[model samples]
Target: IADQDEHCKKFMEALIPEAFRKLQCSHPIDHWAGWL
Candidate 1:
């Protein structure tokens, strides 16, 4: 249905930015930094 499509779109738009910020803050390199 069109309503489901619209809702999914809105949910993704809301989620992507927060996911991006968390991805940015999550530093994988920091884990290796301690070994060096």
Candidate 2:
């Protein structure tokens, strides 16, 4: 269970940045910075 949790954490860490970048590219609005 602990190993699975660690893997999930790493997966999310990798995914969020990529997703955020895509969102920024698609939107590119100033208010998007507030999401951080």
Best by lDDT: 2
Q: Lowest summed-lDDT stretch of 10 residues in model 2?
A: 27-36
- List, residue by residue over 1-36, the lDDT tens digit for candidate 1: 999999999999999999998877776667677788
- Highest TM-score scorer: 2
TM-score of every candidate: 0.71, 0.72
* lDDT of every predicted structure (CA atoms): 0.88, 0.89
Q: What is the Cα-based lDDT of residue 16 in candidate 2?
A: 100
- Positional deviation of residue 15's Cα in model 1 after best superposition, in angstroms: 0.4
lDDT, candidate 1, at 26 = 71
What's the lDDT for residue 13 in model 2?
100
